[model samples]
Target: MSRLAIAAAAGLAALALGTAGASAQTVVSKIKDRGYVVCSGSQGVPGLSRPDEQGVWRGFDTDICRAFAVAILGDREKIRFVPLNAAQRLPAVQTGEIDFLSRTSTITYSRDTAVRFVAITLYDNDGLLVRKASNITDKKQLDGLTVCLQGGGSLTEKAVLETEEEFGIEMKKVYFDATIQARDAYFAGRCDSYVTDGTAAAGQRATVAKNPAEHDIIVIGKGTEPNGVAIAYGDDQLFNVVRWTFNALLWAESKGITQANIDEKLASGDAEISRVLGQEAGFGKAIGLDDKWAYNVIKQVGNYAEIWDRNLGANSPLKVPRGMNALYRDGGVNFPFPWD
Candidate 1:
């Protein structure tokens, strides 16, 4: 073969490889090109994620979606919510039916192997909610009682089993496919109690109870649930985008940057806050975004504390304590990564 012909063939092969590489887009780019994020959240779990009477979605999970939307698309409203039950959430994520799962899903070893759990947004625990009229103050008093759960294959169901084993008592179990179904059955007097994570149990009692005062949440086990956002595994760039976007929320909260004061923060004399707000330029560009990406997220969704206050804090119906969800310096598990 002629030298000219060989050189031409090599050039064409290089061009083809370059084109293919360019076409293999990241999740962030796909979301941007589609003009919105398709996020999967809970099916009307109040304080965690639910739509109001006005059809506006709001909650801790929804706020995470909004923060992600703002970080990637630069517009908080550039996101759509899809509600899924416990049985359906992981499948939807694996099949790409949703771009990201922001529901109150517990991160576990099995799930981590199947999908990437970016960061823990809320630390949770398994617990039971019983009717106050029953006077059930202790878990031992309810031994052998009927309990309604989403299903046995899920984390909540497993937690129930583990609790029974730990307490050395057997509780009769009834299973359902959706949280709403089990919750309805419990409300209708079909079961003695409903099993779920502590945060969700509080949310259910507050949002769905006809008489909120008639229910009491019985804490079963004592440990962190480490619930987090889930995305498809094997995409390092996309994982970093999510992990650090969440980290930015923690970082902003630690630095005292709130939605109301983001603009002021952008012009502050502090080098760290200025860099975080994108006054200095390396943070966003490293994550395949513009310099103001973190700024947009904070300005739109506020920081971790602000989100918690709006959705699950004292003013909300659930009124869940920050507990392990607080910043590390403030006695919680949230420790933001250094932007430097």
Candidate 2:
């Protein structure tokens, strides 16, 4: 063929490839077609995503996935949890193996640039779990110690490195593919310290430690990381569904709406509550969901506070305080957008 004809043929092939790629990127449509949203969770993080004795996944992170299912499929139970570790979480979402990642991963600059993080579901800081016999009261004490952490360059590793640099100290790092592996190695004395999110450290100690009282979870740094669900880049519709589902949880908490009170709140005279509960017409249609989307989430999954209290709060084994995860009304950072 002539050079000009060859160039034209290459352009047509490029157009076809672009069209095929775009068609393959359908996140929400695929979930709708499959009738369930597949969410990525940790292999096991007790208060975050571990299965109970009944083999049922239960945790704050688990509820986040359930909330997504309720928002999209109008049924909280319409979800399948794919167990992943820090190393496997992002790729699972990127490759469309999971709808969104909620395995206690945090938002970093690189991740934010590569994918879309919908909302900050939990506000946490890097923490270290050390044997109580060590009597290490401060995070800096962990400096120069070998630490066990999830490998494949997880944010926990990044946090540890950053903390070491900021404190003018050094640490020996041991890597594992999964959180369970890291915790096992820590318990087995592979490392002097185990580093991860504050709540996760607590959960690990609570669930996996031979004696929970034998270890202490300590904050290692000044900065708090906002953990959120991440999706493939540039799909605004699916992103909105995930983002607003989180907001709905926060908003419900702000309004004192709970699984028990959602029905009563639907009849509330407050205009904002009414609009968010789907008594007003624009919410569901605007988000490409049914009018009862938020209602279903609240009814089936409960609000953010309920999920927290149920999984990580005083009622749960973790017994973690709300801290920064609380709604703004309660002086926490979780302030959702106004529903107008």
Per-model TM-score, in order, reads 0.91, 0.88
TM-score of 2: 0.88
Q: Write the per-residue lDDT of candidate 2 for residues 1-340, one digit (tens) a residue.
A: 9999999999999998985676455677688899998988788888998788998888998999998898888887788989886667777878889888887878989888777788888999888888999888766777778898877777677788888878788889888877678888999998998988899888888888989999988777668888988998878778889888898888888888999988787786888787778877766976678888998899998888889988898888888998887776777877988665
**How many angstroms is residue 305 displaced in model 2 relative to the true structure, after the best TM-score fit?**
0.6
Determine the backbone clash count of candidate 2: 0
Please give, for residues 1-340, the per-residue lDDT of candidate 1 as tens digits: 8999999999999998975575467777788789999999787888988899998899999999888888888999888999898878888888889988999888888888888888888888887889887888666778889999887487777777777878788899998888778988998999999988888888888888898899988877545688889998766667878888998898888888898998887777888888777777566766777788888899889899999988999879889998888887778877888766
Best by TM-score: 1
Query: 165 in model 2: Cα distance from truth in Å?
Result: 3.5
lDDT per model vs. reference: 0.85, 0.84
